[model samples]
Target: MVTNEQSVAGPAAEQQGFLHQVKSFGRPFWAANVMELIERWAYYGVRAVLSLYIVDAVANGGLEFTHVQKGSIYAAWAMVQSLLPLFTGGYADRYGYKGTVAFSILIKIVGYLLMATQHSYGGFFLGCMLLATGTAVFKPGVQGIIANANLGNKASVAWGIFYAMVNVGGFIGPWAAGYLRMMSWAHVFYANAALVALNFIILLMFKEPERPAFEGKRPSPVTEFVGILFSSVKNVFEPRLAAFLVLFSGYWLMFNQLFDLLPNFIDDWVDTSGTLAWLGKTLGNPTMLQNGLAGGQIQPEWMINIDAGAIVFLMVPIAALFSRMKPIHSIILGILVSTIGIVLSGSTMVGAYCMLGIFIFAIGEMMASPKKLEYLAAIAPKDKMGLYMGYANVPNAIGWGIGSSLGGHMYQTYADKTTLAKAYMADKLHMTPEAIAAIPKNQVMETLAAQLGQTPRQVTEMLFAMHHPEHIWLVFGAIGIASMVGLIAYNAVVTRLPKPATV
Candidate 1:
C-alpha cells in the first residue's frame, strides 16, 4: 500500500471523487434554467413589436405617439428594469426563491394581458412597469439558484449553458411573434401571457435549493432591501466609477438602437424580397407566403432575430477565443466591430446585407459582453464582490435610457420617411407643418410618388438619397468609437497609477 504506484492511484481517485461531488448539483438548478428560457421568450415576444406598436397610425391598431413620448416611455422602462434588481435580490433572499418566482410569473401574466388590451399611454406605461418589476424579481431568483448550487469548477460551463438557453429563447420568441403579429399585434401579447401562465406548472414542481448561511444579526428585510438599494446607487456615484459608467453609457446608447430604432428603420427602407423568396423556397409553405409576406417582404422582427441566431450558434466559440484576451481590449475591439456592423446594417436597404451586418454585430456582442462582468470581478475586493457587481448595471441603465431618447429624436428628425416627406412637401409645395400634418401618411406617400413620377419605393429611395437618413447610423457609430477611445484613455491612466502594496 505504501508503494509509489499505490500512492499515485490514491491522488487520481481523489481527483475523480472531488469532480463527482461538484457535478452533483440537484434538480432545482436545471429547473431554474428552464424557467429562465420561458421567461425570456415571453419578454422578448412583446418587446419585438413594442416600438412599432407605439408609433404606427391609430387606424393600424397602434398608439401613434410622438417620438418624444416614445423616447420617454422607453427610457422609463429601461431605468426600472436595470435598477430594480439591486433591491429585488434582497427581497428574493428575504422571501423564498420559489414563491418569488411564482409571484413574478403571475405579475407577468397580468402585465401581458394588460398590454394586449390597453391602448392608452398611461395603461401601456402601467403594463410596462408591472412587466419590468416582475422581470427584476425573476432575474435574481433564477440566477440565485445557479450561484448557490455547488457547481465548483464547473460553474463557468454552467453559466455558459445558461446563456445559450437565453439566446435560444431570444431567437424563437421574435420569430414566432413576427408571424402571430401579422394576424394581430395583440395576439403576440396574449401568446406571451399564455406562456407565462404555463410556467405556473413548473413553479408548482420546483423545490428550493439550500442557500448559504448569513452570519450575524441582519437588518429587517425592508431595511435590508433599502440598504442594498442605497449602497448600489452610492457605489455607482463614486467619482472614478461614475466617470467610467458615464463613458460606458455611450456604447449602450448605440447598442440599444438595435431594439429601439432598427425595427422602424428596416420597415421604412429595407427590401425583404430576397429573404422572403429564400424562406418561401426553404419552407415551401404557402400560408406563410400569403399571410406573412407583404410585397414579398418579411417582418422586421424576423430580420432582427438573425443576431440572436448568430449568438446561439457562435457564442461559445467566440467566448472561448476571447477568453485569452484582456477584458479592456476585448471590449474595445467588440465596440469597434459592432460599430462597423451597425453602420453596415444601416448603410443600405437590402435585407440580405442587413442580416449580414447583424451577424457581425453578434460576433462582437458575444466577444465583449461576458468580459464586462469578468473585468468588474477582477477589480472587486473579495468581500465586496456582490456589491461591486450590482453597480455594474448602472451603465446599462444609463445607456438604454439615454440612447432610446436620442434614437427617438434622431428618428423623428432624420430617419422617419414620413417626417422627411413632410419636410420635402413643405419646401417644394409651399405647405405649412400644419398643412402637412393634416395629410394622412399613406395619402402623402401616394401624392409624393405621383408628383415625382416614380413608384413608392423609388420615392423613398429619392428621399433617402436627398436627406441621407442613414447618417443616423454614422452618429451612433461615432458614439461607439468615442467610447472605445475613452476606454483606452481610462485604461492607460489607471495602469500608470501606483499599485498599493499588499500586506
Candidate 2:
C-alpha cells in the first residue's frame, strides 16, 4: 500500500516549464492569492506612512517623536514581526492556517484602530507592538498553506506564483495608503482594518486538505520558535553558514531602505511637487478619492512595488539567463548589479531624462531574493522547512532593525536640516508655509542669510539648502559602496570554502 505521507504530498518530480505551471493554479490557488493580496495591502499601507506618523509635529496631530526615537520604535516593531514566526509556524501547522489568520486579523483591527485614536505617542507605539504580533502570527501561517498546497513537480512554480501574489499585496498597500494619508492620517489605519476584515471573509470559504501526521508528531510552538532562535544563532557561528549570514546581511541593509528610510528621505529632500504632482495628473482625476488618500509624500512603498513589477517583467528572462550559475555566484552578481542600480538612483538629485534605476534594481532584487529562498529550501531538512523558512526572515529583521537606526542617523545628522531651518524661519517671518513660499526665494535668503552670517548664495548652496537634496543620496550611496566591499570580501571567503565535491 502507498504510504500516507506519499498520498497526501502528491508526486515529486522534475520542474515543469513556466506556461504549463501557470495553467495549473485552480480555485483554491486564486483564493489564497486573494487573501495574500489583502494581507499585504493592509500591512504595507500603514507602514508606508509610519515614519511620518511618528515624527510629524504635534500641531500636525502626529506623535511628534524625534527621528532617532521614531527609528527605535520602528526597529522594535520589525524585530517582533519576524521573530515570532519561529513559533507561530508550528502553531499554524497544528491548528489551521485560516483560523490563525482570522485570529491575527481580529487583533490587528483592534490595534490599528487603537493606534489611530490614541493620544499618547507611547500608546501608539504599544499599539504598533500589537499590530506586529498579529503580523507575526499571520505571515508564516500563510506561507505554510502555500507550502502544503504544492504537491508535485508543480511545487516550485506554485511557490513562485505565491510570491508574485505577495508582491501584489505590497503594491496595493502603498498605492492605496499613500492616497489615504493625504486626507486624514488616521484614515490609513482605518483602511487597513477594513482590508483585513475583508480578508477574514474570503478565508472563511476555503477548506484546506487535512494534513497527514508525520508520524503524528509536532512540537510546541514556543519550544520550536525559541529552539530555532538559539539554533540559528549557533548555526550562524559555524564557519561556512556564518560567512553566508554575514554576506546576506549586506543584501538586506540595502534592500530595506524602501521601508526604513526612503519614504522619510523623500519627504525631507526630493521635490514631490514637480514629479509626483504630475503622477496625480496622469491618473484619472487629480483629486480623486484614491489620489486624495495617498497624501503628499513620495510613497517609497511604491519602490518595493517596482521590485514586484520586475519579477513579472524581468525576472523570468533573467532567472533563465543565469540558471546555469551556482546560487552563491548568482547572489554575488545580483548584489553588484543592484549596487549599480542603487548608485544610479541616489547619485542624481534630478535629471532631464528618465533612466529606470528603480526598475533595474528590481531586476537585481528578483534575481537574488527567490534564489536565496530556494537555496535554503533545498538544503534545509524537510522536517524543519517551516522552522527554517521562518529563520530565513531573521536576517531581514535584524538588518532592518539595525538599518532603521543607521537610516535615522543618516537622515538626521546628515540630510536633516529641515527641523532646524523651520525653527529659524518661524522665529523671523512669523508667516505660514504658504506665505513664505509665496515670497521670492532670494528675499528670504537675502535677509535671513546675512543674519545667519552667510551670503544668500552660501546659505542656499550649503547646509541650509533644501532644494539640492544630494546629501541624502550621498548617505545611501556610501552605504552601498560599503556593502559592495563586504560582498567582495564575502565572495573571496566563499571561494576558499570547500567545494561541493570536496565536501
Which number leads on lDDT?
Answer: 1
Give the clash count for each candidate: 0, 6
Minimal lDDT window, size 10, model 1: 1-10
RMSD of each: 7.0, 7.2
lDDT of 2 by residue, 1-503 (tens): 00000101223335666787777766556677777778877877887778777776555667767778877877888788867776676677778777887888888898899889885768888888899999888875676666666546777666656666666666667778878877888899998898888977778677774554645456666676677668656654646555555557666777766556655654544433335555556665566434434534345555435555555556557867977776666666776766666656654433111125666666667656655655555445567554455566666676678877777766666555454454457765465777655544225555567667886435544543544444555555566566657756766765675544211
Candidate 1 TM-score, true structure as reference: 0.90
For model 2, state the Cα shift of residue 454 in Å: 15
Model 2 has an lDDT value of 0.64
For model 2 the TM-score comes to: 0.79
Looking at model 2, the pairs that clash are: 178-294, 179-293, 179-294, 180-293, 180-294, 182-295
